[model samples]
Target: MTIHQFYQPPLHWQQFEEFAVQLLAEVYDVPTAQQYGRSGQAQHGVDVYGRSRKHGLIAMQCKRLSDRDANNQPYPGGPITREFFFAEAQAIEDFPHAVSIWILVTTARRDTRVQGYAEELNEQWEKNGIDRTATVWSWDDCVSHLNSYPDLRKRYYRDVIQVNSVDDLDQMVLETISMAFNRTAFELPLHIETPDEFLQALQDTQRAVRTGELLDRKSRHVIRKSIGGWRQIHNRDWQAALGKIDKDLRALRAGVEHGLKDGSIRRTSNYLDFADRRKADELEELRSGCVRDLSAVLIEAGLPPI
Candidate 1:
């Protein structure tokens, strides 16, 4: 979808989870009567559940990893740790009458190791009559599958997804970053004086880094240098602001730089680009805030405001 459409108020994680449950139910031809009966509980090692018309029941564990994680080394043990496998298998076993499929739905593109772990878990669960199967679906799979459902597809699948593929995860990340932006943006005037607007902008910069959307060492360094230069321009001590920005920028930069050096970033350019844009947008917001603050100060001093 267009970035604008992807970020409609109804597209938060809660809404996405519901959409995922509903989509899976429809795709498998599970009866509508049985669809609402499906249960979803976030962070309990499960996100969606339902019974298929013929294949029996299905259980899904959704991991909505940020684009940052997509562009990183596969955790050595794969995405499914033994604990996660055991918990999903246990959930299936607990519901004995229905056959279950444990699916790991990620925003990341397909990874062989992650796929392999799912296959291995299925085999292990079979020994206990749990009848579980695991599969990994990425943003690419979602777009391809959704295309068949012309109605919903037409509403949500924009050129952005097609162009970026896995990078579509950025829509979600951007939404998240926007949340922080809004929070800090509103709080700016209330928390500090007009001249201290740089501090507010600095907080937003730190917020972006903490959100993990800035995915490059050099990119982050540029941001930090820019913020530092701005802070000096304003001649405010703002040590607290400086520390927060420095810490977050360093952490985010390290992660992205590591991913870049390992080739993960290249493999997931679509997702990374979106994240990069969010960081850029944040920098722009900071710059704008600086200008606003300077104008406010000029007006307060009875000088012609720029």
Candidate 2:
């Protein structure tokens, strides 16, 4: 088994605690897990405790080890000593009734010394009729298990790995809106316009208004205000205009529906050409009118300063 070492740099207790919580959340469908530090009264060695679906309620004692010595090995006479193991064993004993399983989650892999300690603890627990297992997982195992969870991987990719700030989010939203408006502008052919062109122009204006870009321009405050005023004109002027468009759309839809219902809708080239020309003319007029309105609004708002 390839034993993955923890990151070479020292990880703070808080960082380890967060990693543990996230891992447990992914692994066993735990509803909640809590972290406790040395400041608490129960801090002989226990670092975390929580309820888990896979193993009932569990207690975890975490031992964070630093980088290995000159031989690049974990065991040296440092913080994670035999004494530390004994203390953790005692802590697990203290929480016997509350938690079903006791675990030692550590940054160190199971070397000879650590394996010996784990075996000793298991033997002691069996002697006491505790019926609990003392499982040990190195930092590498924990990370590997977490990586296996697709949801956790996605969360890490979207939240932690993707380093986008708030400003970047705002800029992206602005750019997307600008691009959509530009696409609408690009699709219009305004020169050979008709009543259909005028309708299309109005539709484009409606789209711009709906997108908020037409209102978002800082220079068009007065025009926006005037439109707002016109909007309130007995609520009837704007309502009547909208009603007329609705009526026209309903008429077109009725024609299509009638044709379909009567089995008269045919693939005729003349009809297709007329429909295409009408749609093009309407869209062109709509685009032209939208641009004119937008320009007038900007001018009325004292944007040009003359």
The number of the candidate with the highest lDDT is 2
Which candidate comes out best when scored by TM-score? 1
Instruction: List runs of model 2 lying over 4 Å from the truth.
Output: 1-10, 37-40, 69-79, 153-306
- lDDT agreement with native, every candidate: 0.46, 0.49
Name the lDDT value of residue 170 in candidate 1: 30
Candidate 2 per-residue lDDT over residues 117-233, each given as its tens digit: 778888888898877777666655665775577665555434332424533333332232233234332343433223333334334434333322233332432111111111222
Clash pairs (backbone) in predicted model 1: 1-158, 167-270, 167-271
How many clashes show up in model 2? 9
lDDT for position 289 in model 1: 53
